[model samples]
Structure formats: C-alpha cells, structure tokens
Target: MAKHCVCLTLDFDTFSVWSAMGQNSPTPISRGEFGVVAAARLLKLFDVHALPTTWFVPGITLDTYSAVCADIHAAGHEIGHHGYDHISPAGMSRGDEIDQLRRGIEAITRVSGMEPRGYRSPAWDLSENSIEILLGEGFVYDSSMMGHDYLPYRARTGDRVVSGQLPKFGEPSALWELPISWSADDFPHFEYFRGSGLARADDVLANWLGDYDYMTKYLESGVMTYTLHPFVIGRGHRMIMLDRLLHELKDRGAEFLTAEAAVARWAAL
Candidate 1:
C-alpha cells in the first residue's frame, strides 16, 4: 500500500502568547479560552473523521487546561510534550533546560497518563541541550529540526545542540527528528507575510491547500505534515477552511496519524 501520513499537531501554547500579542509584552500567561473552545471543536471534527491526531502541548498548558488535555487523550489522540512553559530552548542553560524538560514531561504524563513519546520545540526554537534533554527523558522522537522541507532524516542527538541543526541519526540512544519546514506552516505567513491575523489566516490556508494538493499529486507515497494553531485555524471562518482541508485530504486518500505513529512506522521502513 502507498504510505501517506498527515501528522496534525496543535501548538498548544495559546494562552501563553495571547496577552503578549495584544497590548502588553506577551503576558506571562494566556487567557483566551476561545482557543480551548476551538481545540475541542477541532477534536470533534477529527473524531467524526476517525483521524488520529498528535497534540504537542506545553507542560503548563496541561495544568491550566487539564480538561482539554484529558478530553484529547480520551478521544485516542497522542499527546507530545512541547515544553514546561513556552520557554525558548535556545536561551536556557543546559542544566536548566534538562530540568524544564523533566518537569514538562512529568506534567504531561500526570495529566494525560502517557509519557510523551515525542517532542516538538515551542516555536520550533530548539537548541543542543534540547536534544540531550529529550534523549535523557527517553523520548522516541523529536520533530523540531528543519534540515529539509519534507524528508525526515536522522543525526546525532547531542551534536545538534551547538551545531544548531538536525542531529545525524546513528547514536544508539538517538531519537527520530520529524522535519516540517516553515514554508509548509501558517505561522510565518500569518505573522509576517500578510501582517494581519485575518488576512494571514486566509492566505496561509490557501497556500497550505495548494501545497497539500501538490504534495499529494507528486509525492503520492510521501508524508504531509499539517501543523495547525488553535488561535488561527480554530477561529470563525478559518475553522471552515480547516474542515474543508481535512475532508479534502481524506478524499484524496491520505492517511492521518499522530506524529509519533507516523515517525515510528517511517523509521521501521
């Protein structure tokens, strides 16, 4: 059978960045329950389609939003650790990073009853210590590298800390790094390209759909990773756009699975 995978991951840092994007310096916390509502609705859609999703949630998000995390777990979605807070890995000391990761993992486990088997850095902001921390935590995979636009390759885990790149796979204790380029994401487009939340959402979705169509046509056996932000993809008209994208991808014979499952299966091959 042709292998096609869509790893739908929500960068569950909604509340953390909500206030900052508003008036004051991105607040120390996020208060937009709108994101929570949107995420639940999105999960409902996934349930209807029977599409398995991977939610990359920060550790603190679980504490503040435990119900949502529990609901996602109850619905059979895989939960991956994003971080303790949305702290940038590049700015932390090695020891501090390790400690942060430990707490994050424990928090997620406490809330979801599943030790995150996978990790994606907050804002894709990864560093050398990040990989070492992830390995020490016994993570099966890390999806924060951006070596190639689509292909998932491997590298030494610890080496990436200083090199600021993907670890070359070969270290016995190395974890898989799932690469999903920025070009395939909506963050940059919405935050930078269009310069307006409303226009950015629409433009990015159109771009993503175009990218998805092309990938499905040319790379039939290839994997397509869809990264959605609840604050953006979960909003008013944009939610409809996301629904259309999901259903259309399903119609095109794509198999949607959690990032953990997809990487594990791909690694085996």
Candidate 2:
C-alpha cells in the first residue's frame, strides 16, 4: 500500500522565543500569553477531527503552563522536546547545548510522563554538536533540518565545513531527520516580527495545501509535515483556515499521524 503520511506538528514556544531574543517587554510577553488561549481552541478542533498530532514545546513553556501541557498529552498528542528556553543551538557551546537538552528532557518527562523521542531546536537551527548530543542521549529523531520536503533522512555527524576549504561531509548516524521547511512553517507567514509577517489566511492555506498536492502527485509515498504555532494559527480566521485544512487534507486522503508515529511507520517501511 502507498503510505503517504501527513504530520501536523506545532512548536509551542510561548514567551520563551521572545525571551531568547531579549524581547522581554510586557507586550511581547503578553503576545506569548495568547498561546495559552490558542492551545485550548486547538485541542477542541483536534478532538473534533480526531487528529493525532505533535507539539514540540520548550521547557520553559512546559513549566509555565504545566496544566496545559498535560492536557495536550491527555488529548492523545505527542509532546516532543523543543528546548529549555527557545534558544537556538547554533553557536552555542557544546556544554551549554547539552545542558539545554538535559533540562528540556527533564521538563518533558515531568509533564508528559514519557521521555520525548524527538527534538526540534529553537528557531530551526542546529549546532555542530546537536546531532551527536541527541544520539548520545538516545533521541530517535530531530525535526530541525530541511534536507528534504517530503521525506525523512538519517542525521549526520562530523561534517568539516570551513571558509576557504572544500567541504567534507559527515557520516550518517542512527538518528532520523524528520525535516522541516520555512514555507511550511506558520511563524513566517503569520507572526508580525520586525514589522513584516501577516499573510492572508487563504494565501497561506493555498501554499500549504499546494505543497501536499505536489508531494502526492510526485512521490509514491512521502511525509508531508506542516509546522504550526498555537499563537499564530489560533486566531479566528486562521483557525477557520486550519479547520478547513484538516478537512481538506482528509478529503485528499491524508492519514494524519504524530511525528513519532509517522517516523516509526516510515522507518519500518
């Protein structure tokens, strides 16, 4: 059977993302607070559709909203590790990155009552040591890279890329790379950052659905991952668009699965 999977994943960063950027003003923090409200709305929609999705949440967000996080777990959703404080691992010291991972894992386990099988770095950026650290800590997959649009690949280690030198590629590791892309992410489309983002819901919806249609047309079996944020997609019009997306994808024969579940099925195949 042709297994074309669709994984709907959310990055529940809440206020930590703003904190990471040093934007700790009351307004920015309040903006993050809206995510809490959005989460509730999303749960209702998912329950209505019986969708099994994933939420990659930061440790701070998890701690800040422990009850909400637990509710997400209770609703039959996978909670993947996003990071401790929404700080990207790129340019971070190896020790600091490992510290972040440990904190994130601990928080996730504390709330979800299960160790996270996957990790998605904040801001979708990874350091040289991230893959190795995750593999060492037994992470099954990482969804922070964009190596492919409709397929997952092995995470690599030991790449030697430097200025004024030929790039030496790394060896593939056991860790899976459940890739992501900017176009499929909602932050850039909806979030008003640096005075720029705010796309029409219909336009963003068209782009997202178009990607799925293209993948189904070209690939016999592939994973179509759409990244969303509660604070971004939970707005009234966008929420309607999201609901439409779920039904539309269903009509298009989408078999929605959590990130971990999709990875397991893909790996087995």
Worst 10 residues of 2 by lDDT: 1-10
Among all candidates shown, the one with the greatest TM-score: 2
lDDT of 1 by residue, 173-230 (tens): 4667788777666555443223543454556667776776777677745567777777
Cα error, residue 143 of model 1, in Å, equals 1.4
Q: What C-alpha lDDT does candidate 2 achieve relative to the native structure?
A: 0.94
Best by lDDT: 2
Error of 1 at 124 (Å): 0.9
Cα-based lDDT for every prediction: 0.73, 0.94
What TM-score does candidate 2 reach? 0.98
Runs in model 1 deviating more than 4 A are 18-31, 158-173, 191-196, 200-202
lDDT, candidate 2, 1-269, per-residue tens: 54798999999988998889998999999899999999999999999999999999999999999999999999999999999999999989999999999999999999988999999999998999999999898899999999999999998899999999999999999999999999999999999988978999999989999999999998888999999999999899999999999999999989999999989888898
TM-score of 1: 0.85
